[model samples]
Target: MATNSIKQPLWAVVLLLPTLSSCGSMAAWWTDIGPSFVLQNASTGLLTHSLCHSNNTPLYPTDPPVAFKTKYAPKNGTSLTATGWYDTMTTWASLFYQNNNDDIVNAVYKCNFETGTYEEIESDVISDRSGTPPPNAQTGLSVALLGQQEGYRVFYHDRARALHTLKFTQVENWSYGNPISTSTNRSGLALGSMFSGVRNVTVVTPKDVANIETIRLNIDNAWHITTFPTPLRGSNVTNLSNLTSLPYDTSSPPPFSLQGWDGNPKAIGIAIDTVLTRHIFYIGTDKAVHSYAAFVTGLTESGFRAQPDQSNEYWPLADEPNSDFAIASHLGSSTIRLYYLSGGQLIEAKYKNGNWDPASRLVVANTTVFTNNTGPVEEDNGLSTGAKAGIGVGVTVGALLLITGGVAAWILRKKKSTTSDVEAHGDEGASTTAGGAMGATQPASTAQSPDVASQHAEIARTGSGLSTEKWDTDVKDMALTPPPRELESPNLASELPQGIDRNELPTKHHITELP
Candidate 1:
């Protein structure tokens, strides 16, 4: 038995050979997610992460979240939590965090898709806007990066509760922007974009008990503030701040205790489907993950899902969920991947093919760093979901076709993948977005991803716009290789670290700005 176990790991390396050789970087499933996620060890001040190695060795299967630590963590960094944005075009990852002095720090990691490695970590302390108290990031960190030439944006709050953005350009790293808006948004500061392209960097902030305000960035570089209506569930209007009980969902099993809406905004996670539907995920009082959608129509309740623990027991916000969550989707695909902390283990939940995945995959973590992806996972297609119809996932992986028969069971699992509320209390949203244009600019962003043609991706890797910074690495093409990863091992959670806390959380504050 021992000999066979040893042999199994060796065979995995053999399996990985084909996957690694043809091309690297399959957007989300491969490079997109590999850089977007950064796990941490709070006790050790170390960061654990993985490359785009989905076909990991059997000794640790489910493409185990590989353990690694970057050398750039600041000496006085407290909490050690981080958020990152992986610019697919540049293969650059800007990881942001709060240092001991409460100053914003960005540790940049340059990655190579062809080589399959995110080898080095370099960092810098972002400068303020001439005189803005150094823009201390007093709240959680969130980031959103534009593809190709547009640059990137990171959001946080200073001690004064004012929202600040740290943006990037080839001409500069992160130059602090003037304060855009201010409120009592102590937590739940998320930066995302509903459509594609370098249009609006949507900012979701808790203004107060009565409202949630969104400050958006336009192509012309001006900021626009919009107030969205409360979440609607089947004609009933209710804000997350007022709900104290679980909304009924036929998909959910009954809970243990019914009373638990502590009115706190623990965290907010957002995912976008290739179809252009956006789903926002958050934990409800009953421990179920609540989802709501945002479109031109307005905010609508999508559904809620309560995942099962190891014991198969269900509790109402009594255990598991620490409320810190991060979700991202691959461009051109419908796959939405979400990560959250449960009993110190990183719980990975996926929504794809119109259903929420029930797989109980857990990544052990002493701490975890979260990041943002522009869109969903690689879809069921040929090239990074960029190829529609018969195009192969690889711009052209003839070899991958040979292995399809070998991993048929995994593909079958993918085919079977498998939603909540209605309430209206105010204006749905902006109607000025005729075709989702970025404020009188181009039509709603045509979200860019890897398109295939003779082993090259349609999107360019190097940007002529960036002013040639020293941190920038030599340009390399991300071979539009289809991900040839294996099926997830069912026992991934068991093999990883495990534990759950029964602690109850006290509610925090929400935003309160109206149009």
Candidate 2:
């Protein structure tokens, strides 16, 4: 009787092993999907720099060695813009600009973090195609990496108002997609306004592309954001075809509208943090910089709400503004950095602890660097907002074990009582059969342990480089801030073009434009 009681409790423990193993697997999956903070140490090095024009003195200190320099003078008519991302230990930068022949070209270069040396891939001619006219040559370009396999895709809008895309998979392999229009007319998407991050890509334009009405891409990889029909300018509704539309078929209508979209596509930029939070910066018609935050829901739904934030009048008030801006989320930290061009200088502002830090100039006016402002892109820093939540799951597992232990004790007590009754009845043979059944369950438990341990090992290996203690500390410091107060009125709406209604604009626009 005593031996039977001991055996019954052991069998109960073996049955609970699978449940414990599942808890560990859930914890690891939570960590895997979180934001990456792998490149925290790589950003300290000096970046390449040059004067915007030859005659001007260097704006930043020359002590930090320049990574690369351009011989062309800004005053002599040159156009240049740069975008970059980090791929593990390698920092990749792509520059797109108008060359001496007034044609657009793309140059790709990789920098080894350990060596700090730049290797340039042979430059590729992106413009000057057979059917493309001189006026329709590329005017602006933006590049984004779609993981390591897809390489990079470059976006631009031409003079004919058509959106064009060029993909570069390797040094010699380049492919161009057909041109697409944002409106029914020949007018296409705006120049230098398309931006992409992770799985999401957005373009800001005054009109719709093809029959698609929204400017954002959802999880379906189709143009499916719910939006009001673009305001009509004239009676003609031409059915212009978009030759460059992505190969995917669009069969479903978008479910929701792009929040805070004011129908203007000019002077806008976007960035996504490690956890997929989106920040959009734009020069409002008031000539001040305004930012909006879009919170993602599930895999496909996003709530785009206007952030109650705006910068002083730091942007130019010109019709065709030369100012541009970029955004990046600091690695391993909740800090978000905004870099913009103002008065020919590179100015930076930080958003942390729920407030925007005052803007400070980093490089003097006209100092140029090949930075798109979307910081190191490829580091899988094993830290993210979701990873921090996994700690809570660990606590819950402990509670589950406690409950399971109590159940085992109760079962043991019942078995002991049954054994005593059986001994009194002289049913020794029945007790032996029950003990054999318990022993038979042991092999299945043995088989499952190896698989469970293998899964646990894999997750541990993936997160081995990250420190859980440091990740927890960083998350606690980055608690979400409350929404900001709305801007005061007499704002950007007063400066809008004739067709736009001021009532449709946000209320209380209290912001000043920058010089």
The Cα error of candidate 1 at residue 167, in Å, is 1.1
Q: Estimate each model's TM-score.
A: 0.52, 0.45
lDDT on C-alpha atoms for all candidate structures: 0.34, 0.32
Q: What digit string (tens of lDDT, one per residue) describes model 2 on residues 55-79?
A: 0011221222233322221111223
Off by over 4 Å in 2: 1-59, 62-81, 86-90, 110-121, 128-138, 170-172, 180-199, 206-214, 217-266, 299-303, 310-322, 329-335, 341-345, 352-355, 363-515
Residues forming the 10-long window of minimal summed lDDT in candidate 1: 493-502
**Which residue runs does candidate 1 get wrong by more than 4 Å?**
1-36, 55-92, 111-117, 185-195, 209-211, 218-222, 226-263, 297-322, 363-515
TM-score for candidate 2, please give it.
0.45
Candidate whose TM-score is highest: 1
